[model samples]
Target chain A: MIGIAAPLGYAAYLSFFQDRMIGGNVFVGFDNYRRALGDELFRAGLWRVLLFLLVQVPVMLGLALVAALAVDSGRLRKPGLFRIGIFVPYAVPAVVASLMWGYLYGDRFGLVGQIGDLLHVDMPDFLGSSWMLASIGNVVTWEYVGYNMLILYAALRTVPHELYEAAEMDGAGEFRKAWSIKLPAVRSALVLATVFSIIGTFQLFNEPNVMQSLAPGVISTSYTPNMYAYNLAFNGQQFNYSAAVAVVLGGVTAIVAYAVQIRSMRKEQGK
Target chain B: MSVNTPARRRPRRASNALTIAMGLMLLYALLPLIWLFMSSTKDSASLTSGFGLWFGHGFHLFDNIGDVLSYDDGIYLRWFGNTLLYAVVGAGGAAFLSTAAGYGLAKYRFRGRTALSAVVLGAIAIPGTALAVPTYLLFSKVGIVDTPWAVLLPSLVSPFGVYLMRVYAAEAVPDSMLEAARIDGSGEVRTFFTISLRLLAPGFVTVLLFALVATWNNYFLPLIVLSNPKWFPLTVGLNQWNSLATGAAGSGATTTNFYPLVITGSLLAIVPLVVAFLFLQRFWQSGLAAGSVKE
Candidate 1:
């Protein structure tokens, strides 16, 4: 409670007031929240992350699902190698992953630049403003797909072999068994991954923040909500407003995640 | 016999196709790492000039490693040690606390148990970053900001770890076993320590690994809370080095780039966790499955 709840309550309390240059800390009613809601930078960050959640979450999860099913199918050669090979990236820290990808995306000094040089073609800039979010998404998907795959694969492993045997006896094909038996068995795990991804998406900071130096012009301090709050409190000395932003972000995350869980539960019941 | 031959032949073809597809995915995953390895062996000049997917004219791997380990009064080594300390004490303590609390929640009926569980569940939903600013403010008031406590104290609380352990304990530890231990005159704590802890080992490892990775990969909390270079973890420190390399480090700009050192340090920073995962992945996967894949 001290670790989790106390700070949350404190942040909530802090959100209702403003820290000022001359007045010090003073109660401002809902003025801070009013500012947060009206803050263009905060809203833009939120919209960017929502777009990220929509596009990146599905791509990463879809890759994980396919990897899990492929591994569970027992048809791939050296499945363990494939599993571990893909999973090795999960062990790499996000800072390192971002740095590595940032280096790779550099049009002047990166691999893509060299490849473009060799081909005598103008390569698209991965770190350009238009493609920056996609580049970050690629890094995230690279780091997490294996972790999610492991979750789904572990769930797949728990499905009783007898069920598959029964299905086989009923003349079910590989695709059919996987579709009906395996997918349903892993629905809860899928939902868990989704919720985790949703939380991760809202908390998106490390990749973009670390890569900020590589593309300073493109990634402003308010690139993401967390980054915005950090910069607000630390850089702008707007602690109260930062707290309000944090609270709003936290509230949105909890609501979206809770909605996902509730919807998944309802769907499970309907089935 | 004809039907059997076609069925067998079809699966063989499918298997080959599946293998090829998995191979492609494997390449996609490994390419960056391979690039990291390949590029880290080059001198700074060759880093940009040489082909990134292959080696430079001469190998400078050892020189880069030496520079990374020894540069700036061996700050990289200090960050490595800091990361080690934070991950060990933070993750180890979290797993222990989670195990005890989870067992208590799973086995014992007490006042406010439901409330406590609900709080944990709610905490799990609230992204950690949201609380980070408040935590920093609270710590600042308490005079722990810019100190290791700022990082370590928050790191110790793993709500998901507690939740996972609760789920695992409810299934793995039997009330009958506790009853038997009590019949033999074991106190509640003794029964828990001596009996239930054994049953929860896999779950313990699972929570430990998760907490371990989280602490190791942690960046934002430390970045916000700690301003002292002496207290910086590898993630923050390496990012600092990266900025320096790119001539982006605020106000203290140096013309000398740290690309080789940064790349080499990154590779070194990841080695321990990668080795740990390679050795102990099965335990983590199985434990996670048991804890999470509940109906």
Candidate 2:
């Protein structure tokens, strides 16, 4: 508790003050917050990640939901092969996964480049500015889709056999059974995956950071809020302001996550 | 029951279309891994020339592994050993602490249980990277920068792990069992260690693996705390090698064509984790579902 609390408390304290060149770490209350709130790059970075979440979360979770349904449907042959296949990527570190995909995304000697030349076709640059966001999203989705599937599938497995038998005896087909039973049983898992995705999207650092080397100038120093704070502290040496960004981001994440929890809880209760 | 026909006895199953869709999902997941394995086999020249899915002219997988392991005074092996130490100590310690704390919260009603639970829940939602800079500030102020404790200390606290153990403890460990142990003149600590810990194995291993992966994949935390490459985990080290491979010259860069090394090194890094996931799938399957207990 001390380990987690002390730093957060320190960050809250630090967020209120600003370090100045001439003033020698003078306490300037609310100045840091004012600057961070109005900072365009920070806002842009947050918006970009929000956009990422909007697109990536559904695609990833939808695929996970489908995979969970298929595996739990009891007709898939060699389910282990599919289960392990989808789940294998979850084990790859984000750093390593990003690196592998970065290489694959490369246009020079990467697989895309090799294929493009072999067929003499023009290929859109994946690391280009327009596509970089989605490219990172793809890497993240690939890494986590299976892990989320397992979570949902685990939940699906817990749906009582009695419920299925009741549905089956009513002459419900497979799709009808899934529609009425499996989806409802795993509602909590879906919500959990959503909350996790929200957190992960806001904390987007590793994928973009790793690919920054590959894309060079395409990935600015402030591509995400976390990256922005990182740059503020390390490159710009604005630790006080960086602490402000951290606090603000943390506050936003907590509120949003809490909102998600409340909404899901209400929905579940209403059901 | 005797009137039921054989046609009606067969269970309804998923359609062929769903199975095909699942197969495609499997394909999408496996393509990059397949590419990675194929990339590792080729030497630097053949890596660029051949197709990514198939093996190249020379099977340089062993040679590449040897070089990756031996390059720069065998620093890859050093990083591997460092990752092992951090994963074992950090993850092992985290699992123990979380188990003890969670069990305490579940079995015994302490004065600050509500407050601690609130803090734990808040911590779970807090973005860890958000604390990175402040943590560096605190660590630097306390003069613990560039030390393993900087990473290990933070990794010791796992809110999710605690939550999982609390759920598993409540579900798996019966209060009557503890009552019997107490009647046998067992101390609370002794009874917990002897009785509740075994019942908590699945959750413990799940927490251990989570911590292990977090520490192993840690980049931003270590990147800020430690400036020395000597203490770099494979994630940071391979990244350093990656930037060195980016055709950026004059920063003491390695050869620009060291993609083979990077590819092979990445392959090496994920092998242990993949194996761990494969072996522990059953535990993690249940462990993940255990999270829904609170929900």
Candidate 3:
């Protein structure tokens, strides 16, 4: 109880006060929040992450769903090997993954540079401003698809063998069975994965933060809300404002995730 | 017999198309690790001059590993040791607390069980930033900000672990078994430790692995709390090396060849967790089935 409530309350309390140069710390009421609302970089970062969440979550979850279904279908040879192989990335820390991908994305010295030179074609800059978000999305997807796949596949394992037998008896092919029987059976697991992905997307710090060195101009201090809060507190020393940004970001994430959970629960009930 | 044979044969026959698709996915996942391994074997000069997907002229893996271990007064080894200590203590504490709290919530007739579970579930949605900033402030006030306790304490409170254990315990530990233990005059705590815990082994290991990975992979909390290089985990330490290698931390730092060390360090960092995942796959799958699918 103290673990969750105390810190949140403290942050909320701290958000109401601001530290000043001459007057020391002062109670600023809603001034910090107003400032965060008007901050262009904060808003831009918020919008960027919202965009990231929309595109990345679905792509990652879709890939995870497909991978899970493929493995669970018993149509893939050495499914265990494939499953474990895919899951190995989840064990790799985000810092390491970002460094590895950052190096690979290096056009001058990395894999793409060599490949472009070999093929005599100009390679797209993976770390450029135009492609940075997508590149990060790809890294996030790579790191998580297997983890989500494990959840869906585990859920699939619980579906009785008799369900598939019954479906087969009705002359339903693999696709038909997957579409009707398997999908519904794993719906809750899918929802769980979706919620987790949504949370993960909002907390997208490690990749961009680690890669910031490689692409200095592309990623700003306010590239994501978490990054913004981090830089505000650590770099800018605006603890009050950082707290407000964090509270606002956390509030939005909680509301969206709660809405998803409630909507899914209602849909399950309506069925 | 004919119908059964066709039905069985159909599902068992591996589809060439599916195999190909899965193989592609496998490649997508493994290629980066392959690249990391391949790049780790190259010296700093060869890393940039040579192709990333293949090896360099010489087998320099040991040389790079040696540099990583011996560089900068062997700070990489210090970081590794710090990471091991943090992960072991943080994850071990988290698993134990989750097990005990989850068992209580599951087995006992508590006053606010519904409310408690709801709060725990809701806690999962609370962003790390929400907790981290305030926790840092509070810890600083208490003067534990730079200590390992700052990271360890926060990590021990895994709301998801509690939820998983609650769900697992509800199904795994039978009421009849508890009643029999009670009838035999065993204390509630003793029965829990002796009987229920044995039944919860798979679920415990599952939670342990989850907490283990979370702690080992944690960057944000430690980043905020610990300022001492002596206390930095592999994630932060490796990123520091990366920043230095890329010249992002500004000039005037020694440790000239950090690129190979970073790559080699990254490779070494993931080895233990990968091995753990391979060995504990079955427990994780079954434990998750009980926790998630049953719910």
Candidate 4:
């Protein structure tokens, strides 16, 4: 009962009157929800995060899968070195990584600036309004591809030798083997990585928050839902509304993640 | 084995192409780091002189390091020390607590085991940032704001660590061993610490590394909790510097090189993490493989 009650009680407490509980206000049934849906910033934040999810998740996961498969192939002589190199960024604190990239993206004193001068061409401003999202995506991809790769690579290693041997015996090419055997074998891991990525995409904070200094005009307070919620709670002092936004964002993530899981499970059953 | 020798030759060509592509990918991964290294050596004047990646005439690496360390009465060192304390204590405590909690969940068929597991899974899915506001409010109500305890407490309850420990404990610790220990008159604590804990070494290391990295890199929690710069972690400290630099840039301050200090500080911040990775990479790789599904 303690085990069950501890978590459930926390959830109930948070969901029931999280706003009033935090701010000592009267209960407003679904008014917070209505406010969240009506807020243009909230809607824009959701759309921006969803767009990020659509583009970044696939590219990041694909790169991770490719790197993992490459490292697992045993063809690379120094796979450990490459693995460690790729994984190094995961260790660097996100704020610091953002600063580093911020400098690299700097117009005047950055590497890009220096290279542009050398080539006698104008360097495209990475932190410009049109490119800020993609710039942030680049940083995210750099930080996480190696991490997801490690997971998928670990999963790849668990594929039985007999399966590969059988594939080879049937004159299956490497691509065919990867598609028919390797991909199917690591399906669960791919799903796990994708789900993890989706959750992570919504939780985007440190990168944009840090990069905000570099591109103030580009990244608004509502660049992502997390940032928007943060600004609302702290800057706007609207804790009740912020909590409402958080609840809605959390609900969206949970629903989408659950749907993905259910759909994948159904596909597996069909197979 | 020799069934596809000709096809194998074709794969060799494909493998060569793969290796080249992987090499390029590795270089891409290292480019920003290389840029950081190069930029740290240059003076302020040369910072924008179209030689950012190349070595400048003024080799002020030591000067920059000195400046970063000495800034604000050696506040960077204080931040560094606070970060170390947080990482060591917070992650250490988290690993032990999660291990115990995971052992309880995995080894015992308790009344609400499934419910507990589900709660943990849900917690794992809930982003840490999502809880930051509530956590801050709770801590403030208790008047623990700006205290290390605020950061330390939240760091202790990593739901992902708990989940990983549970999965690892299930895989690494045998049920029969627990029964045998019980039959041999061992206490539950003794069985856990002596037999189960020892067996779970790899998993423990994995959890320790994960927790350490998470706590060490943690910015938002510390950012929200600690208003005092003295209590800041490297992430917050560097960000404060970045913000100050932006202000300086706005004022058009033609001063001695703040650029080098930022670069050098960034480099120093990365060193400990790099060292941790190098020292723990072997254990991490093996632990990851072992703690996951077996081949």
Candidate 5:
């Protein structure tokens, strides 16, 4: 409990105060929160992550669902190999994944550049200002898609085979069986993964931070809210403001994750 | 046998299509690792000049590994050792605590069980990085900043691991077993350590590996907490090398690019994990179901 609560509680406590050179960490009483709410960098980072969540989560989870359904349908050969092959990336640390993708995303010396030159085709700079969001999305999607697939796949395996036979007797084809039977079975798993992804999206730090070097100007210190708060405390020495940003980010993440949880619970009950 | 009728025959053909599609997903997943492996074989120059997807000029993988190990007074080896220490100790402690707490939560009657479980579940949703700055502040106040404890303390608690253990313990450890142990004069703590823990072994290893992956991959906590290079884990140390290379490219710094070393180091970092996954994935499948299998 100390591990879970102390820092967060301290963070909440620290958020209300600002350090002044004259007075030395005086209680500012909502000033920092006001500033954090109005801060352009934090707001932009917030919106950017929202955009990333919208574009990336569905694509990644949708693909995971498809992969899980395909394997669970008992149609795939070497399902074990297929399953583990996909999950191998999840085992790769986010920092390593970012560095790997950062190297691959490099325009001058990266794989795409070399491939483009070999094919006589111009490759757009993947880690450029406009593309960095999607580039980071690609890295995150690669890492978690298989992990989520495993979760859904686990749920699928637990589903009674009797359910499938019943669906078959009802004349359901593969698609219909998946829709009517397999999908409902994994509904809770899907929500769990979605909530995890929601939390992950809000905590987007490693990818953009590690990739910042490769795309210096393209990826800023405030590329994500977590990164923004990081830069504030570590780089700018604004611990109070940073604490406020973090608390707000944590609050926002909890709200969304809680909402997803509640909605999934309601759906389960409604069924 | 009844299901293996003519109706299943059509889906067999459709299964062929599913096999091909899953094959693509496997390729998509494996491509980057393939790229990482192939890239590690090349020296810095060939990395850019040679084919990106295939073997680059001379196979300098061993040579690059040597360079990565020997560079800057063999700091990569230090970082590797540090990573191993952090992962082993941090993940090991987290697994034990999570299992103990989860077992207690599962078996023993306690006040506010619902509230405690809800809090644990709620804690899982909080983004870890969001706690970094505040954690730094808290640790600094206690003068633990820049120490291993700063990294280890935060990593030692995983709410998800606890949740996994709770669910697994509920299913894996029968209440009757506990009662039998108690009747046999085993105290609660002794009973847990002796009987319940043995039954929860698979779940224990599962959470252990999960915590292992988590601490191994952890970046933000250590980034804020540890300023000294000696304490830096592999992730932070590798990024430092990467930045040295990227920093040089970005500006006219005298930072000579450590491109080969960084790539080789990255390849080296993930090797243990990939091996672990390959070996444990079948066993790990049982653990994944523990969550969904819960009431």
Candidate 6:
């Protein structure tokens, strides 16, 4: 009960001060929601995060799948070494990863710069406005690809060998067997990874937040919805408005994630 | 089943290609970490100009370590200590709570077990970052903001850990054994602590590792709740230094030396996680292998 008490009690107390926090003389029920909906930056932040969702999620998951497939095929002689090496980045704290990448993305003293000089072609400034999102996306993809690979690989191992044997008997090659048997078997795990990726997408904070300091010209205070909410509450001191934004962002995530779950569940049930 | 000789010969060629491709992919994954290790040894000037894959001037490594240790009155050491405290206490508490909840859900036919399990499943889908704002609001209202308790308390509720324990407990602990414990005049708590918990050792270790890593790498939540530098974990502290490094880089100050410190600090921060992974790798492998057999 104490587990429940701490959070619930805190939320209740915060709820009581919504009027004072917002600076509205009139008591407004869900007016903060109205304000949040009307906020341009909030909408832009949402769109930016959605854009990230569209691009990065698929790439990250695809990389993970390919890595998992490669590692799981028993073709890799040193599977344990490869697995540990791949998963090592996931264990690196996000802040450190961002810093390391931030340096790499630096124009003057970065590795890319040195390489660019050697090649006699200017490397794109990763922290610049045009490429910042892609730069952060690269870091995120690098960090998580292996983590998701481990999950999918673990799921892939659960697939029975008899299915592959049967496929082999049918004169199916490795690609055909993977497509016809392995992929379908790990479909649920893939869906789980997708849903996790989506939820994680919305909460993209650390990479961009840390990067903002590294490259302030590129990252805005409202780079992502979470960053927007953090700035609104902490910097702007508009706690009520921040809470409203947070609630809405949480709602969007929940609704989308729930829809994905239900749709996947229904698909599984139909199968 | 005997393979046909002609077709079997073709499969070997394809598998060889696949093996080479997999090896390359593993190399690609490890390249950045290798880069980090190499770069950490170099001076700032060499870090930019020298071969990125090779070491340059090992003098700066000791210098960087000393600088990192001495920075802002040795706050890095404080952050390290606080992180250890957080990981130990938070991971320990999370494991205990998760075990108790998981055991209850797995063994006892409670009224709301299904509902509780469903809630936990739903909670697993909700990212920890989503809950950060709500948790911050909740913590602030109770006047625990900027305190270690704010960070520690929230770290205790890992829904995934609970879910994992529940699933593992269901299979690993036999009901017959619990019945036997009951027959031997042991209390439920005694049975749980002695018999069931012992049986759940592998599961416990798995949960502990998960909780420890999650809490150790937890940057966003601490960033939100704690403004006090004293309470900042290594992630937050390092980020602050990175921000300061960015400012100094802009001004072209003598503090350019701090870049080495950040690199070395990052390298040091990675050690504990590597140690944890190494320590737990055997257990994780065996646990997953065991899981594979049952499935």
Judged by lDDT, which candidate is best? Answer: 1
CA lDDT, every model vs. true structure = 0.90, 0.86, 0.89, 0.81, 0.86, 0.80
Query: How do the residues A160-224 of candidate 3 rate in per-residue lDDT, one tens digit apiece?
Result: 87777887777888889899899998999999888988887887799999999989999998999
Q: Fill in the DockQ of model 5.
A: 0.65
lDDT: the better of candidates 5 and 6: 5
Give a tens-digit lDDT track for model 5, residues B45-164.
Answer: 787777667898789999989999899898889988888989999999999999999988888888999889988988888878667887888889899999898888888898998999
RMSD, model 3, all Cα superposed?
A: 1.8
B185 in model 5: Cα distance from truth in Å?
1.2
Query: How well does candidate 6 match the true structure in TM-score terms?
Result: 0.92
- Estimate, for each residue in B1-295, the C-alpha lDDT of model 2 and write its tens digit: 1223243224445468877888899988999999999989988888877788899997889999998998999999988888888888989999999999889888998798988877877788999877899899999999988988887888888898887788788888999999999999999989988888999988888889888888888788888998888888899899888888886434765575678888999999989988998888788767777876345
Off by over 4 Å in 1: A117-121, B1-14, B251-256
lDDT of 6 by residue, A1-271 (tens): 3454444344333333454635764445677788889999999999998999999999999988988888888666677787887888888899988988888888645777777888999898888999998998999998898878877787888777666666677788878878988887778778878888899899899999988887787789999999998898888887666766776787789888888878988987997
Candidate 2: lDDT of A30? 93
TM-score of every model versus the real structure: 0.96, 0.96, 0.97, 0.93, 0.96, 0.92
DockQ of 1: 0.64
In candidate 6, which residue pairs get closer than 3 Å at backbone N, Cα or C atoms, i.e. clash?
none
Mind giving the per-residue lDDT tens digits that candidate 6 earns over B193-274? 8889988888788788878888999898899999999999999988877767767335655356667777888988989987
Judging by lDDT, tell me the better candidate of 1 and 3: 1
Cα shift from native, residue B268, model 1 (Å): 0.6
TM-score of model 2 vs. true structure: 0.96
Q: Report how far residue A2 has shifted in candidate 3, in Å.
A: 1.4
Of 4 and 6, the candidate ranking higher by TM-score: 4
Best by DockQ: 3
**lDDT of candidate 5?**
0.86
User: Compared with the true structure, what per-residue lDDT tens digits does model 5 show for residues A56-159?
Assistant: 99999999999888777667788778888988899998999998888887864578787787799998889889899999999999999999999999998888
Write down the worst ten-residue block by lDDT for model 1 chain A. A107-116
lDDT of 1 by residue, B134-186 (tens): 89889999999998889899989999998999999999998888888888999
lDDT of 4 at A110: 73
For model 5, the docking class works out as medium
User: Which candidate do you rate higher for TM-score, 1 or 4?
Assistant: 1
Which regions of candidate 5 are displaced past 4 Å? A117-120, B1-14, B248-251, B254-257
